[model samples]
Target: MTAPAAHAAPRIPAPPSAPADALVRLHLSESPYGPSPHALAAAHRAVDDTGTYPDPARTAPAQAVAELLGVRPDQVAVANGSDELVLLTALCLGDRQRPGVTTADTFPGYRICLENVGRGCREVPVDGIDALADAFDDAGVAYVCHPHNPTGGVLDRAAFDLLVERAAATGTPLVVDEAYLDFAPPGTPQVPDYLGTGAPVLGLRTFSKAHGLAGLRVGYAVGRADLVGRLRAVQGSMPFSVNRAAQAAAVAALADRGHLERVRRGNADARERFRADLAARGRRALPSVTNFLAVPVPDAARAERLLERDHGILVRDAGRFGLHGHLRVSVGKAADLARLLDALDIVAPVTGPGPGPALPTAATAQERP
Candidate 1:
């Protein structure tokens, strides 16, 4: 929402590819299963109304989101996607004089958005959450990706509690990007669990992952009424950001709990089978609660190129976002993973933690196009 020069997007590594329909898209953690039929019908119906402007307030989806989370409508703000919320929060949250902070070796969007807004970002290492918590004392805002993107790891209840306490103590805006939260198991500590505690915390949720609405790009935030108000107010700059189809689709998607449950169960089964297949080949992926796995490779950057270039299979090079030596592979359809497994054996082969470096982490961290 500023000058283009200040809002340049991050560069992602892309090799020339076969047509999208022909490629194995295990790169973006998109749902292989499509959206609920009800959602699809709603979106198509919405398309007919495209001649009219979308509801600037995003009413239907916001209320649906609030209901889903058991939060009041005033505490929800639906957006084009959580990415928009990230940029908006980076621009308008907390003490702007102070810089924002997020975990290093995590998502680049937090740093990118903060810097674009002229608010600098401080990054704590992936294993440095305690350090991240302490930094909140002075940070304008803080971000953590629960069931973290590439690693698919979730913070334990104790760690999440400490973060909530720190945010309350310092009054810093703590933003939890829960884009993949739908795939995480039950009892995973999330933003809503701490809302009643009166902490300045927010959770960014999306229909793109488990709900399979990535193409429609609908995401929302739920938190304190005040924080939600600020984000809602900020939407004036892009009032129709959430389009007719996306808003309609998201509401329909949220109502179909059965579809979401099926997706969760399917993904869990696929992820485990994929992990077992890797184990059978003497390769191991880090444990994950989300829908992707961080598979180690001798050289992540090189492996990324070879996978797509040689096999027309796309997997994220974790190094591009600072977590080196791993490929962030989405747990896609069974046939696709089988193909990727076959391809990886040739491209990155099983290189046990050799002399170089122990690949730093068992898990790495996701990104945009």
Candidate 2:
């Protein structure tokens, strides 16, 4: 018999290219400053150890994060990113027979994760905490993306306290995603304080934002030791989920408080300036405590495309997150914001009828004392 015909190797498509130098990346909420010098040095050093397997326990990063948050290493579970932690939470805690509860307008990843695992998700309005409580009563998991994604609204301490109490009373798992909490003012309530309340709460954080390490993809979840243990068990299966370079960088980034503070201050200034510029141009920007501002536009999709194609500036169309006719623009460096503002001035004049009733502002919820 003739030799079998040579098999053709499947062609793998090339991954998408990174943003070009001229492309203003206000879409992803990435830090404009990039990683700290210490983190960069640590990452470079880690590159020399590429031949060895990374620590599966993620011990160094875990201990660093635990110390920073006043939690024990056993209460910390590191992952490839907080997104992975979110997925792990769903896989480990969600039940097909029950549902996951969350705000209708959220980061979208949580709903996607829950639904991907064959569980239903119930979404209530962001301000509908009572409805959320009722939904959580019957849910296998509850998620609240504090400093909520597109709108950037944060739930007050009282609201979070109530949620924690409900979680305790109902014996449900609560996931508080603080992906942008580092940008909020100091003294903002965080997840570590609730750990001793006998409630199953998982506080998810990422090094991507204030630490300027989005490219590294490192994050962690901290909570009760038993609950964290469960997450760690799931994380164990994905050995080296967080590579050595990322873990080292995250640890170094945590120690660089000056860098983080600079990011917070710079972002706060840029956010306020951007919002004010928009207001001066007869547009409304939803008050934000996070690094991005959500501004209502005539058409989100059209505005996003116009900015990219015409101005070489990229922005997220909040319609993807159920906030129609709004654009989520990241706070960039002063020069970058100047470029964006100029581009906005050019694009804003031509945009047609604006968005409907303004979404609720975070002013009521996130007002700094």
Indicate which candidate wins on TM-score.
1
**lDDT for 297 (candidate 2):** 75
lDDT of each: 0.84, 0.82
Model 2 lDDT vs. the true structure? Answer: 0.82
Top model number, lDDT: 1
TM-score of each model, paired residue for residue: 0.91, 0.90
- What CA RMSD would you report for each candidate? 8.2, 9.1
The per-candidate count of clashes, in order, stands at 1, 0
Instruction: List where candidate 1 sits over 4 angstroms from the true fold.
Output: 1-21, 351-369
